[model samples]
Target: METRKGLKPALVAAAVAAAFAAPVEARITKIEITSRGPAFGGVEFPGVGAYERLVGVASGEVNPASSNNSMIVDVNLAPKNARGNVEYKFDFYILKPVDLSKGNHRVMYEPPNRGGKTFGPFNRTTGGNDPSSTTNPLGQFLAPRGYTMVFSGWDKAAGTNTANFNATITLPIAKNADGTSITGPSYEYIVMGNATTTSYNLNYPAASLTDKSAAKLTRRARIDDAATVIPATGWDFVDANSIKLLPDGTTFAANDIYEFSYVAKDPTVNGLGLAAVRDWNSFLRFNVTDDSGTANPLAGDVQKIYTYVLSQPGRLLNDFRYYGFNQDESGRKVFDGMLQWIAAADGLNLNLRFSQPQRTQRNRQDQLYAEGIFPFAHQSTTDPLTGKTAGRYDKCLASNTCPLALEVYSANEYWVKAASLFHTNPAGTQDLADPPYARYYLMSSHQHGTGNGTARGSCQQLGNPLNANPTLRALFIALDQWATNGTAPPPSAIPRLADGTLAAAMPQSGMGFPNIPGVQYTGLKSTRFLLNYGPQFDSGIMTINPPATVAPFFDNPANGKIYPTFVPKTDSDGNDVAGIKVPDVMVPLATYTGWSLRAAANGGPDGCEGSGQMIPFAKTRADREAAADPRLSVAERYGTFGQYMYARGNSIVQLMNQRLLLDEDAYAEYTAGLAAVRAGSLLKDE
Candidate 1:
């Protein structure tokens, strides 16, 4: 590995210098062992002989010499693995890694929830949740090839941890040169607070928390337009965290943004979340002296680092790269490769004043601030709507800090996640092609994920039961080979401009989504509002008082900026036509969609905030006719239960041949799916 330009003088440890030059300034100062146990249930980690799980915190400070002495990052690393150590690369998460230069040349990861749900290698109170073996299934095979597992925390606001996967961060408060505390404007859009509900709270403490008289609130029914400021008599702050609406709770409607202006105290440069990861990875990979006041463990043996991010964390990756955090302070690079899952061209809402990184483009009812903005592609292109053009990787590429990237998405992204804008122009005339440095895929027929879903008691459709984790596992392997060995991953499966498969900005009725009985369909899509968080926002401090909201003409489809909301063409079953088609969709177990409507009773009809729906086909031809299912029943389509099984088996073979499904996992999933289908007795031969 060659050193990129800016960090020419980095101090590389003897071990690391033996291979390549790296940056200096930060290294893991202390490896606090909270718990150590044999990894993989005490079984050897395949190629790595006997590996042990070293659970603890890797504490230290950033190089005061390379950076400001004020920032000391204490990363809580849960589960650092080791054995006789045949070389290992730090396979890490949504945003942290311990040592980079120690072992193998490759690594993988999954940052599940709010950057805190990173549980791997630990037998949980729940059960065996090993992604490689079960959940994702990529690890089972990847383990044999040699990749180290790593997980740590970057978010200071992450919730309490569960079991062995506990993590949180400590951040320094930001202040001015005068030593005065920083205070600024912040806002919140409660997804669904009870309108009449008294004592409603804010996401962060407010200057008006105690003084109800100063609390000012404005309301917006939608995120794309101006909000009417409610008179002071319209609302009252009940306490530090509580608020009440006048006239009645109903005054607070679903999907409304309640803009409040308050001077927030003790601002933590939360954007430091990116900086912490940058310095930490540089420390690990280069073995440079760290603010930690310690030695680098895996210094020389490190080859390349890879990051695999999920959903929210995926957005974190988007911002991390967009902000140029990949180029560490010492001028070393952080990741050599990255896997972004379902981010939908959006970066984290974090990094700004009082950031709500945990929030998202709340379907149709809330603000879509950072989720849809500039740098929609790997190679920055002119914002057809804004006229500003910059690639997300421009800085990284310039510094040679850019990593090979693979992006995966769900069909839901096109439906409302703003995924369409990636391929189609704001005006919706054509599709955008991907750059050579990255590959993008839409895991069609799925939603954000199958978790966080209920029985659809709030909706008419049955909840989506499909998990695309299986597809992710296979792609992870492909990405690994591509990054480590230069074997290009499969050509991305996306709707193309030349192809007629690309559809855009279509009203609900135009997409041709069927109206299944009892199933709700709402025309509402997630709002991709263009927000100006005031001028100082980029400086990590918001200066605007009650930030103004407006929808530019380019954003309005009626005006047509040429940036359109696009989705892939679908087959008669309504599943997307592109990407790695899963067996469940290929074999037609049911109608699996990336889009579902919220039941009206549930304050919906807006896309079910973020879950797809699964409608089971009829069991028999008679039942199909009775239900008037537009698609034929599985039995009718395949003739018999045995026939359906055979067809599913064949589909698995096709997927394997196409490289979408590896031979090893394909058979296992096929057998399991067959057994389950048999047990459920979905279709029988007459």
Candidate 2:
């Protein structure tokens, strides 16, 4: 890889030359570029001119004998290439400026969330999977800034490969030392949305498809209750990887918890996904070509690398750092900075035998998976409950390879994903300050995804449509400036125990939620428990399929014996009192809550998975009194559209001054909001 002009010549050349020209160990052997064409149909970005897209397969190998890969669960048992290195191949996609001179010396890497290429709120474009389409303004924001965008597959079970976004990896299955099959306890849970749904594809194939004796099927009324075993005769194995209820016309209860636990075989070397990401990013940044001499597209252009991952894949980023995958084979840093979006306190259910990377336990379904465990914080600290001390950056800190991190999550994370554990101690008694290298921000009064702020779906209340994208765009710029220049970002804007904003989640525990008309405020949250998955749990092997739970000592008085957790306190309008105040939350048209209960038909009273409620205030003061609504009327809060715009504009200006909102985003949102307000679409006063 060559150094671009304008950088410190001696330093850049010396560093890159030594890394690339030196005798290589285990690295990317080949990059087979399958397709090459103009991105966005030859659309020219502002200063970057036109960008080109490169889609390909990246083949790499890792030495199992090396200490760098020893943490991989079954690396020792994986099949090796002729060079005695464990081999892996994954699909990759890259969009870079056609001319290197016109590019910024940075790579914006987005690891696919379950095989889909999403920008994680940074881009307002729809169908972000297809970055090459001219119809969609995909990559319009970053491409103009001359950023080289990158993506690649890491999950082995990335089911179907869409033409627009196919990022799948191939990994070897772990076997016994004698080359025999290895099996482990695998569990799958299903909640039928309707009665007609009968079959489910298991995470892994059953060890013995014919042997129904060992496999057990059970049903429970709720996620927390004890499950009653459904007799084996009530179900049949449709195949090695699927199951169906017995008697062709049989149906399951709409919201009942159906659990299946069995001995599953052929576990992929799932942990290799971490290595794949590390090495690919390393290759793009430092190497000019692979061993096969396939040119590294952005080899000379990449001086800094940053990653943005959302939801499940965001959890993967957490696992990647925890297991020391941030340091490549040459002991160099992989990502210079990381923006982890929406993955709160949970780690991925990966890096273990029979790994289920997609399992995320919500308040209503998929309960008790191997996630939301200890070592939730980035800084190493002692867990008062488990008596263990560790952190996500422990390994990186020891190796001097820790990346600057920014953890951005929404209110849903606080309600459903145990986000409080990310900022607090394991016992939740006190808030722990973030490390100097990290910043944590909360998207106040927002849900997991953007919504239209309407009453629809199976939830008991109207959907929350608080858009956090404007704030996200600003923060991303802040992160880039902090990493590229010496400029520090804005202070973390999260609720804290030190402040009065962070409080108990339940209304009974003094959350101070307002009583809106026709709204049920049960204050249900996804409870965390101290789980024991047998003695081998720490070693990434779960001997017990459904682990036993142990109550923590620091118990919550409101929830009885359970792990302590907290949520951000609410204002009179039910919006979160803390965090970056967006325009919608500032001006206020309705009360937005992070938790929304499922309707009676689905599962009444349980918090809707990843959903938040938007209960509109009454139109007029008379309407509020007539409906017995405790919340004030929208007209009373803002007499006219002019007042509404004034308030929202003031809020946007404040955020801009703090560098928490960009000018372009602020202007766009203000105009759009003003239009809606003028049309009486945003605030109704009939």
Model 1 C-alpha lDDT per residue in residues 137-231, reported as the tens digit of each score: 32454444455655566676666453435445555555555666555555666545444444456656665455544445666654444667677
What overall lDDT goes with each candidate model? 0.59, 0.80
How many angstroms is residue 10 displaced in model 1 relative to the true structure, after the best TM-score fit?
Answer: 18
User: Mind giving the per-residue lDDT tens digits that candidate 2 earns over 1-686?
Assistant: 22333345664575568555665556788999988998878888765678888888999989888888888889888998788889999999888889867787788898898888878357656546667664754445677777788999899878556476678899998889899889888888888888788788888888897887778888866554666777888898889988889886677778887878888988899889988999899888778778866777876667789887778888999999998888887788899888878888889888887787767877776765788788888878787766899999999999999889889998999989889989998788889987989999998888887765656577888788887777777777888888878578888989999898987765533887887768887777877777666689888897755522212211333223356888999887788999877887887777887777888777676668888888877788998999998888878888876777778888889989999887777788888678657665545433
497: Cα error in model 1, Å: 3.6
Query: Clashes in candidate 2: how many?
Result: 0
Error of 1 at 344 (Å): 2.3
- Whose TM-score is greatest here? 2
